[model samples]
Target: MKSQIRVVWALMWSRAAVLRSDPERGEITTTVIVTALMAIAAIAIIGIIVAKLTQKANSIDLG
Candidate 1:
């Protein structure tokens, strides 16, 4: 049983190492960064639109 456990542990460790060295990892990081930037840009655009609309609304003479 102990030998079986050791073999399983070794296999898991090797798999982890293989995953850690994968070249595709950078693609995921790049994708996440791009998505975050796009989200931030969208929020900024919405804020600008809201501000402009609010300014326009306040300028209407209600008197």
Candidate 2:
């Protein structure tokens, strides 16, 4: 079991070394501003939906 674990670890390290050595960033990366805007929009939509649902449920007066 220990030898199997060591072999897996060595393979992972080797792959990482290759990826690090040949670093390449193509033109498909979104900027920080776009990412932040999308996140905020998603959060706002979720918040509004949850708030409206809660308000509706509260108005029902379920006892």
List the global CA lDDT of all models.
Answer: 0.97, 0.86
Model 2 lDDT per residue over 1-63, tens place? 999999999999999898777756332355766888999999999999999999998899667
Off by over 4 Å in 1: none
Across 8-42, the per-residue lDDT of candidate 1 in tens digits comes to 99999999999999988679889999999999999
lDDT of 1 at 54: 100
Report the lDDT of model 2 for residue 39. Answer: 97
In model 2, pairs of residues that clash are none
TM-score of 2: 0.48
Error of 1 at 17 (Å): 3.7
RMSD of each: 1.9, 8.4
Error of 2 at 14 (Å): 31
